[model samples]
Target: MKKVEVIQDFPEVELVGRKLGPFKEGEEVEMRPWEASVLEERDFVRPVRDFSLTGVRKALIREEKSSRLEELPSSFYRTVSREVRRLREGGEVEKAEELEEAIESLVDFRIQKLARMIISSVDLGDIPAEEQVLANFLSQPLTVWEGSIGRVFEKNIDKEVGVHAKKVRRNI
Candidate 1:
């Protein structure tokens, strides 16, 4: 769900077989994200605290300074993607490019951090609901890979130790 503030008056709209709002200017409402996105496309409303470059910068800096994953709004990535698309369509190419670079760097850093957490068997603290799904998905594959690799090493080490033990016994 997203909370949006209406910027223009809008009459009741029937969408997806449901009637939504006769919203007035200055009204704030909570709606399904899809509905809010539809209204947002038409400029009827904007997200209260829409994603901004300054916010992204702060998040990036915070993430860099921490071992734990930085908490972000649940719809953080979706909001950033939408904003970047809007910027490109509006001919704000330079701003869009800068935003894309910053977002990419942040995403890459978070991914690396998440992988480290998973490898270390550490608790995933303060992760957004949206990213929790990603962590869950990655956990299974990583566990499998680690088990497979550990078994291979275990077998080789066991064989080497056995051979060394037999050699020592013979010398004794």
Candidate 2:
């Protein structure tokens, strides 16, 4: 579940056999991702992070540093960055800073999770299907793990090659 803010008043809605929100504008709510997406499509709600301009900036910076910027459609980040700058210029400094911190925390959490998955895959000599998908989506080359685990295993071929072979076999 993720946090989202109601952008407009909305009557009660049923979700997954449960009732959620007859929410008022500006009300913050915790909701499942699917629920959020439904509301977002109507422009009746937006993710909490969307309210923070500085957070968007920091997230973009982190994505660039990690070489994941290209993984996202350019228009998405560009739109966010434009809004962030507008908010800053409008003197919403405090709000922007707070949002920046939140975004940074979120990005750090993701990076840590990726690092853990990489290490675990190295130790186990096999990457989970979900982790492989995530790594690919992030444009994180498997070769990045080569140095750390290349020779750790007794196999003559490199670990990267072995992992690629496994991935191909699994796909087939």
Candidate 3:
């Protein structure tokens, strides 16, 4: 869900079998993301909270200064990606490039931190939902790897116990 402000007054609009609103010009309302996107494309609404390049820059700075992965809003990546695409579409190429670079750097930092967390089996306490999903995916392989190693260790232990028993029987 996203909050969007109506930009023009309109009667109830039926969309995809749902009736949306009798919106006034200044009205702010919560809508499904798809609904907001549709209205925004028609110039009927705009996002109430837009993520900006400055916010991304600040987040990158914070990530650089921290040892742990910095938490971000759940919509962070989605908004940033949309903003970058919007900039490119609007012919703000230089700004879009800069924003993309910052985002890549931030992602690199977080990936390193996530790798450490997965290796150490640490809790993903405050990461954004997107990163949490990624971490969950990556951790599945780690779980399998750990189980495989445990089986190898158990086999070696059994071999050692069998060797000891054979020596004991020969002595007896």
- Per-model TM-score, in order, reads 0.62, 0.34, 0.60
- After the best TM-score superposition of candidate 3, give how far the Cα of residue 146 lies from its true spot, in angstroms: 0.8
How much is 69 displaced in model 1, in angstroms? 0.9
lDDT of 3 by residue, 16-129 (tens): 899989999999999999998988999999877545677778888898999987778677888899999999999999999999998898899999999899989888797777
Worst 10 residues of 1 by lDDT: 163-172
Where does the lowest 10-residue lDDT sum fall in candidate 2?
67-76
| RMSD each, Å | 11.0, 12.3, 11.0
- If both were scored by TM-score, which would come out higher, candidate 1 or candidate 3? 1
Identify the superior model by lDDT, candidate 2 or candidate 3.
Answer: 3
Estimate the TM-score for candidate 3: 0.60
Clash number for each model: 0, 0, 0
Model 1 global lDDT (CA atoms, 0 to 1): 0.84
Q: Which stretches of candidate 1 lie over 4 Å from their true place?
A: 1-50, 163-172
- Writing each residue's lDDT as its tens digit, candidate 2 over 29-129 gives 99889989988998999877643555455655665566322132224434455665776899987776666566565446555656655544533123334
Position 34, candidate 3: lDDT: 95
lDDT of each: 0.84, 0.62, 0.85
